[model samples]
Target: MTEYNTVLAPVLSAFWDQPNSWTLETYLKNGGYEGLKKAFAQKPEDLIQTIKDSGLRGRGGAGFPTGMKWGFLPPADGGPRYLVVNADESEPGTCKDIPLMMAAPQFLVEGVIITSYAIGSNHAFIYLRGEVVHVYRRLLRAVEEAYAAGYLGKNIQGTGFDLDVTVHAGAGAYICGEETALLDSLEGRRGQPRLKPPFPATAGLYARPTVVNNVESVASVPQIINRGADWFTSMGTERSSGNGLFSLSGHVTRPGQYEAPL
Candidate 1:
């Protein structure tokens, strides 16, 4: 019988097994925010282009190129734009986002900062599923840790880029997994999908230009920012490049999150 690859790729899951892995100190010690540091050195547009050239796609079923989605936003217009993280991973076969946030919350946090910078967003939100109270508490603490470390506040790393992250939990609903519904639920309304045309890019979250991306998509930003587009494109196929977390379930021997080329 042929044997499948047993070794894990382990990019986002690299430090998951470390004791105190969820803490800011642990994350920083393991080269956590270096991606954000490198991102600050470069212009936001350049960063977007790098991601575009990398061919990284959204892992939230759409498989849309992540960089392209960012490019779709209209000009900044000097007004506020927002980045909403779709952490409500309620899809049938989706389980990567929660575990990622639980094991290495910094990955998502760092990704949020970079994506916010790339898209000119000062405020970002993580809309989590409310039923997972433990996960919610873990993420809340993670955000607090990030703030105390100067990673999520004014003049981050002396780069003059100010940002604030909010962790919001949704009143469990599969429909909220839809980006628009998630936004509505986030706004304290009953969870329901909104009509399209005025897409989130144009008007979202209090009628502001918004980029709603899945947790994995946002989490992938740090790696692309730190490693470069060329490195990201080295994995997967020509069109679908880079690696991602595969949610494995069932009676399989090593069932869990598996990181592999997409």
Candidate 2:
């Protein structure tokens, strides 16, 4: 067997706690943001390096390297930039983010903060799939709770980092799942894909440089940051280890967002 399979598969599963472990209280009790605490104590560059070492790949239907993707940004060039969490997973049979948001939206919230801080973005957007009004409402409530708890706002956790997070809804379009199409829909335009190369990392949302990451992708940030990169990376395959939100749908005896190793 490959070494990744031996170490990664069991490591992530070992953390599997009760079903409600998604809740903020539950997550905290289980030593969740202990990583966040540690991350905030370290230099941002070191945190990024830990992720690169851990090998956390993107799970938004595309297995891109999370760290390398963050590295693609230009240094706070004074132009506005954004970290857009794509929660609009309209892909046929894929179902995870909505439920995760419903059960433990703060996971994504704290992740948004850590991600924004890492990339030097002050504002982050959680773009929801418009059809799920109920889910959106749940997210709104969760964001409110997080804000009230000091997770989202100026002076996050006394780190002197000011950040704001907004959860926006889309008009319900499959095309909107495409990076550029999502941006267009976010801007109130008809949904459609745009040219590539100069992708979202360079020119996105309002023509300002943006980092368009999937909901699960952004949510995974806090864990990678808080835990040593080696600890987070010690799961999955050599290329794609670390826990992933597999929005399992259809056929399976239990169709749900199963957090599994890649």
Best by TM-score: 1
Task: Show how many residue pairs clash in every candidate, following the order shown.
Answer: 0, 4
TM-score, predicted candidate 1 vs. hidden true structure: 0.96
| TM values, all candidates | 0.96, 0.88
lDDT of each: 0.90, 0.76
* Candidate 1 segments whose C-alpha is farther than 4 A from its true place: 1-7
Clashing pairs in 1: none
- Candidate 2 lDDT tens digits, 76-126: 787778889889888777777676777667678878877787788888898
Q: Alpha-carbon error at 126 in model 1, in Å?
A: 0.3
lDDT of 1 at 253: 86
lDDT score, candidate 1, position 44: 91
